[model samples]
Target: MAHDVQHYNLDQKFDFTAATKKGLFTVLGIGAILLIIGIIMAIFGGGHAEAGAAEGHAFHWYQRLYANLWINNVYYTGIAIIGVFFFAIQYAAQAGWSAAIIRVMLSLGNWLPIAGVLMIVTFFVASHDLFHWTHASLFDKASADYDSIIDGKGAFFYWPMAKGTFPIFFVIRMVLFFGFWVFFFKKFQSLTYNEDLAGGTSSWYTIRSWSAYFLIFFAVSSSVAAWDWVMSIDTHWFSTLFGWYVFSSWFVAGLATMTLLILFLKGQGLLEMVNENHVHDLGKFIFGFTIFWTYLWFSQFLLIYYANIPEESVYFLERLSSDIYGPFIFVNLAMNFVLPFLLLMTRDSKRHGVFLKLVCLMIIAGHWVDFFLMVQPGTLGHNGGVGFMEVGMFLVYGAAFTFVVLSGLAKGKLVPKNHPMLEESYNHHI
Candidate 1:
């Protein structure tokens, strides 16, 4: 197909649509098995810490509860839920640079149901680690250590928060979150597909309506969802900044993933609908939001650290005290912040697909480290550094994430052909 140099660039068809290796899915299968075996081994392997003397409290199998499970499931599955609706957003906005890769975003977004299932499963597993509020002492009013926070809050945060509060209420909320994505995704997906079938403003009108509602849903749900999952880890500690923090990291990471995946697809000869223009746009995003995310990171850290408030400061204090985390704190900031900030500052760098690719790779790695720094110190404490558990967790999630995106690419046309501005996008050279 010869592209007209003026209004059209010969649309290059990407030939590489690699079949997702059956092995990758199988590996998740094996991981499920190993996860089960590992859980059991860990359980029995501990053959007996004397009751009430382990890790500042008694270790009980029953700690697994409703809210705990909810937290875990939402975190793991949220990438899909949030990703799809957001993709819809960029499209509804008629964003040109993002339009080329919108198909993959839709595909990854569709994986929300699967991710939701994973979230539910994690909730079930989490019931064991959390839910100490069920203890007789907390509710009995007889235990001296019992505080009003636990007792007064028990019915709300403890029982309801646990794995089985009101099964109906719990499932409804989860369903609603997933439902928002499913419905919005279908609306936009149908509209986009329709654009290809019928051109003009018809698709744009439908997309714009869907996008407005989607943003409403995105703002409300992301806030609640963040609290339900990550913030709940330290139920006692609160941060109004928490939700924004989660979004900053996930959004940037998802975009970087999109850019990298596009590059990978191009390498394999697929997404022919995409070209350097598309890549350049993605790179520009890499350059722009890399800075935005860093701002958010600094804002959060700066406020929390300077306030010197015990609750907020403890979060940082824990990180600095730990040998492993103490050092990575700077490295984490450097990669996620300083480096991307400096490197991606140039238009030339962003326009250079190869340079942008490196910047994106750096961003992705940086976000991973960000997650590591955020999670490890809190969960594993000083004793837990980057070890097998962390590595395995990364491998399992990383592979799963990869397989999901590729499988999504295989689902539809690589480029949205009938977008109202797609012609503009194709001819776009800036």
Candidate 2:
């Protein structure tokens, strides 16, 4: 069958209009207001008194604030890195269908440098409040608060230093991972921008090579990152599937972000070369990975539940049986798995803008809840729920993320004009 190849303006750049900026700023202002209100309520509402009593310790309102910070930190950071990771996957697999939307994927990396700074700074500021192992007494044998399990794992965070002192090794790993990620992002950005001007396949070959290396590094780094950032929050509990579980959640959320952006651009009459076929493939990824994420979640939950090990089962017991978080557990599943699975199952749903948009938004918010469940139970005990604070922080992070990604998108050629497989993407039918 002969296909009509549509020609596109190779030099087209995204117009980062003042109107769009205004809209984003409006969202930012609203988010800021909500955040302030949530803070005031936390201070005056007496919500933490119950939580403190339940946990046998004084739970400060600031701890809940810090937990929210960490939750959005890890959640949005995952979304950002997934962008770069997905871009690399395209080149490594030599996939042609995504060529037209490749730049959209790369734009998410623009948040990485900022995210790295936030992750490090938040860790320093909120370490004691959010991370259990950061308490020096936990590592001190003479202290009543000493933890044998955490002490045994001390080298992972404090090697070359006393277990109770500072987490030199952990900090180093954090720095090195972000350093490498930023380095690679800059490299990819330079090469792709150069490709636009030079118009040759040399950059393509180089990118494929670099993509292979990035994938290799990301495979190891992403897993370790999950263990460090999220799994460690439940200091006493560990899951073999936690890394993949976290990765799958991030992957689906990233896919949703990408789809939403693609749809928004289409509404703006940009990326004319990207058609329903491209959207369908993206939908398939969301659909497939939603199931993948569910599989990982169930595997982790079932194993712990079946083993009935006090150490492992306690993790779920804390959330599942609690009045504060039990409802959210079902909400998380419905939004992340059940809803996306059913909503996106149809071919028409995958191809249509309205359905895709709805599901993408749900997946994005749903995964945030997933992260909320993971972080809050461990850090806030029964203190946390999706209150004004949680909603406010998410919106703040969401607006900032959107602004960064869109600003980056506006700076680049919306399409990879010189990409060798551009024609294949134009003719993509499935």
Candidate 3:
């Protein structure tokens, strides 16, 4: 597998500050639109919330639809935001090959604050509507006067505690996730920028320090965040490997997204410096992480299915029963595992821009399924499938997602010319 080096024709002093401002505006605009639409649907979801009614009960199909969309929106936000972690870790390790795309990752990573704000607002607005656990009054331990579903998990569904602890921890963790991202983003971004100008050893020293701290941060926090934000939607089900499961899904998807963005930019007549070698690395990551994702998915499923534990088995049970969801589960596996496993195995395929981009698209679509499966079960319950609301919301968020990324490109110089590994990345040929 050999790749001929390529170079961008853009000015050496490309200014991305305008692009960054534009992207920030686009993110805010799209996010604002989504927030408005989702809220409207959530508010009009049912007949109405009676002031004195304790055991509020109503079924609004539209509300369910809005909820799913909102969930997906929050999820995409989380994935995009967590990209900061990817950037920081790579920088901390002083990874040479990825230096070319570090600036792009930073642009995507900077979307964290906007995403986080939307998620928090959505949580409080419809807290009871989404999680049974959020409605503590519904779970009366003393008598059979309350909701049975909530009663089933009353022990862990402590209202007072959830009210106090849930938001506190969720916010704290969000802060931690972004706080780490911001610190590293600044440190590395600064170092990379400075290295470009100064050509000093201090840049390398700054990056080296991040690797040790990053692994520890990732190990402790990734699982906790996954458990609370993602796995907890079901509240009843739990998986020890859930953290790795989420991480693998996002890792591949995130890499593929970066690849797609580069290809997309190239189509728009930019990123000329990005070449076949970069595509090859992106393809390999897409392929490798897809396999890693599959391994985790299967390992978790096989063990849980074999154990036949009621608590664990229910996670899969919901998916196995639905029309849209059941088919989606298989598709997710096929795209994330079978397709990439076969396609990326051949060396030439990874380096071919057209082939690589198509497969990257497949991986992204598949992981969307991955996140959908993890969430839709707890959300829509039995026999859930595609509806107008889902499609409509997808339209809204998908556009917003696109707007955010493109606008973000103009934020800074596309190439991290000062990054210590920039030259290595530009010269890389594996």
Candidate 4:
């Protein structure tokens, strides 16, 4: 079907019709209401002092909000960063089949800088609730709140009081991570746009060269970013594979997101260049990464479980101990690993657009739960519960992300007309 189209003449611009704008706003508005309601539940949800609360050992309502906010922020950041990673890899490989869909990845990559800003703001706003090391008393030996474990790792995450700085190391690392991603994304985006105009190998060469450089930077920064943002939440617990683990989850989610978007466009009669061959490749990614994510998940779990180390085991222990999170721990594994592994294993399933989209959505939601388990157990302990706030925040971020990515897609040509591989991509087949 795709071979019949000698050239893609579809409107490259996204039409933000009144209905579309209304839909986006409605989602955002509904999210806001849900967020407010979630906050109320968090603040006053546990009616009368329960077992933990009655004992004066309960986590406060604000803590739950802080935890939820931080986790969602991290989840979105991973989604955005994965876009840059995807683009960088394709450029590095000089792969041609993706030239047409490259815009979707680039548009997705555009969200990183914005995600960076939101992450920084969230850290500051929820510092007390999220990181114990952020508190001055945690480092003060004389203070009752002093924690030796936090102090031990203070050189990296904690700033000295004499410097009168907050998150100096943390903030610097955050800035560097996002700065690296945003800088390379814009450079590559410009090269692609320029290639659309100039139609030469010069822009291509530059993109490929920079892609190699970006990948190296990604290897180090992605892990560190995960360590800084997510791992640090469990300040006392540590994992050697945490960075890779987070990266796997991020990569799969990114592929799933891009896949969903492509399907949506195809349904609307756009992306005539995109065929089942393209969808199949995407399914392979979602399938392969789902396993990779599971491997890391189990590897991390197995190593910790077998070693039986108190510090490391405590992370899972808290999650399992929680009435709310206990079941989700299995649910997280099932959605991310079990379901994707089973559903996407077949060749026909990968070729089926509808089935692949359903699996993609499930994997995306599963990872959210995976991330929620990673976060809530460490931060909220047994105090947390699924409610309006969690659902609403998901909508809020989803709406915001959709708006930004679509706006980006609208700004550029839907097809990379001048790309050297445009023909190859249009005729791609498995």
Winner by TM-score:
2
Better candidate number, 3 or 4, judged by lDDT = 4
Model 2 score (lDDT): 0.90
Deviation of model 3 at 153, angstroms: 8.7
Worst 10 residues of 2 by lDDT: 1-10
Question: Can you give the TM-score per candidate against the true fold?
Answer: 0.80, 0.97, 0.80, 0.93
| Ranking of candidates on TM-score, top first | 2, 4, 3, 1
Instruction: Highest lDDT: give the candidate number.
Output: 2
TM-score of 2: 0.97
Off by over 4 Å in 2: 1-6, 49-56
lDDT of 3 at 405: 61
Computed on alpha carbons, the lDDT of every model, listed in order, comes to: 0.62, 0.90, 0.66, 0.82
lDDT of 2 by residue, 99-156 (tens): 9898899999999999999999999999987878888888888987888999998889
Residue 55 CA displacement from its true place in model 2, Å: 8.0
Instruction: Summing lDDT over every window of 10 consecutive residues in candidate 3, give the lowest-scoring window.
Output: 1-10
| Candidate 1: tens digits of C-alpha lDDT, residues 93-163 | 76765666677677657567676676756655553343333344545556665656546644544445442
Better of 1 and 3 by lDDT: 3
- Residue 90 alpha-carbon offset, candidate 2, angstroms: 0.6
Rank by lDDT, highest first.
Answer: 2, 4, 3, 1
